[model samples]
Target: MDDPVLRFNLRELPVPMVYATHRIIRDCNEEFSELFGYSRSDLVDRSFARLYPKHADFVRTGHMWGAHLPGGKTYYDERIMTASDGHRFWCRVHGRTRHPTDPFAQAIYCFQALTRPVVLGKIRLTDRQRQIATLVAQGKTSAQIAEEIAISVRTVESHRARLMKAARLTNAAELVAWFSTQNSS
Candidate 1:
């Protein structure tokens, strides 16, 4: 017996989905519009940078993913993103490219809102701070994190200090522990 064919519709998936080419949004589902507070017309042919809370994030995430997706890797991460109303919220993003050899030429992404409040060492962090904190939690030194994000080590240190102070933690170790515990929960 032949296996039955399976069919799936991007629009009917009930998740925020976007198809892009070279970082420009080509098409998106209604759920994507509802999630990001953008109309389909606003997103079509627009750069995906509009959804990022900061330019640094757009750059950093692009650099990070660019290094992987071309190798046929699927990238996943939790991050804070801005909606059309400029309100920031955490989201889990998953993405992959249709052409592994030239990943950014065409890709698909899905976003899931993480409405649960994110507390870094007890203090709420901005999206950038959260990114830095996640790196620190992974045992990356400020210099290493800076290199990875294309930022200076001093800036990474500054963000780390702010994260520590906001969480009311005395040192990196405590901050890492707090972040670890938060993720495990």
Candidate 2:
């Protein structure tokens, strides 16, 4: 990676790549700028939160990184991301940290847009609810979701009930279907 040609190849590899520290973009390749419909000048030295669909999403996702990055795991997730013009797409994101013990101190991430139907878009979910909904959509059981989010199983059920009520659904199966359905314009 220290070789100039190697560096040049990676930067122009046609994958959206970014380098960030403390969740702020330190630099990004040309493909990344294009992917987000932003000039390199516009994105550099800015918080990555601007690219997320909601402030809640930004905050909630950071929690995931905090749990994994310190262990030097290659974090991965498929989530909806937003472009500068407000266009949203599902993308599989992969990230790694150079500073494992202080992951947010330095990290690199890449994005690959997915072809799946958009998720979590039709619902107006709060941060915690959205986190639970994501897990639910991933087919996680109530017990698993509770353990991951450090809440009680009963609390998880409460959220599921609330989500069902909000979506006018009757049960977990319907709740999952409601949350996963594609946008109908």
Candidate 3:
């Protein structure tokens, strides 16, 4: 039998999968295109940045996840992704690098769109707001978020306040409920 991990028919895979070179998509399965509402041709030779909701998300995810690839780790995260029609939704992204020594040199990724979206329509959050929102949704306290991301607790609280105001929420508990449909589930 063929080695399942080392060989498979990309086109026939049920999962949305992409083959990328240094984070630039070079090929993708049919499910990948369908999930993102793009043609395979549209993604080929394109930077993965285009599918991200924000440049900061792309940069943050890349640096955060790519850090593990060099150590032969398969990194996965649940985050937001954008479709071609400008619709954004939650997705579980999983990736692994074949060339572990030079991680981004080549890698494969699979994306699974969550059944229920956490972001319901065009609620645009600024880069910092998005970061703060993610941390908040993940159940991180203001102090914990500040320490993790190297920002002042006051700054974190301020962002949370703004988010609450924008959402017309009364408190942090409500704010969390307003943001996460259960972070990822």
Each candidate: what lDDT?
A: 0.79, 0.80, 0.80
RMSD value for candidate 2: 4.1
lDDT of 3 by residue, 1-185 (tens): 88667667888899999999899998899999999999999999999999987787899887766666775568766688889998888888888888858889989899999875454434556767766777676677999878766789999999888877877789877876766653321
Q: What global local distance difference test value does model 2 have?
A: 0.80
lDDT of 2 by residue, 74-160 (tens): 877666778999888777789999885988898989989876676445657666776787788778899988877779999998988
Look at candidate 3 and tell me the lDDT of residue 54: 74
| Model 3 spans > 4 angstroms off | 1-6, 118-124, 136-175, 181-185
The collision pairs in model 1 are none
**Taking the tens digit of each residue's C-alpha lDDT, what string does model 1 give over 102-163?**
88898999999975554333355676776788778667899978877778999999988877
Compared with the true structure, model 2 gives a TM-score of 0.79
Off by over 4 Å in 2: 1-9, 117-123, 168-174, 182-185
Indicate which candidate wins on TM-score. 2
The model with the greater TM-score, 1 or 2, is: 2
Q: Estimate each model's TM-score.
A: 0.73, 0.79, 0.71
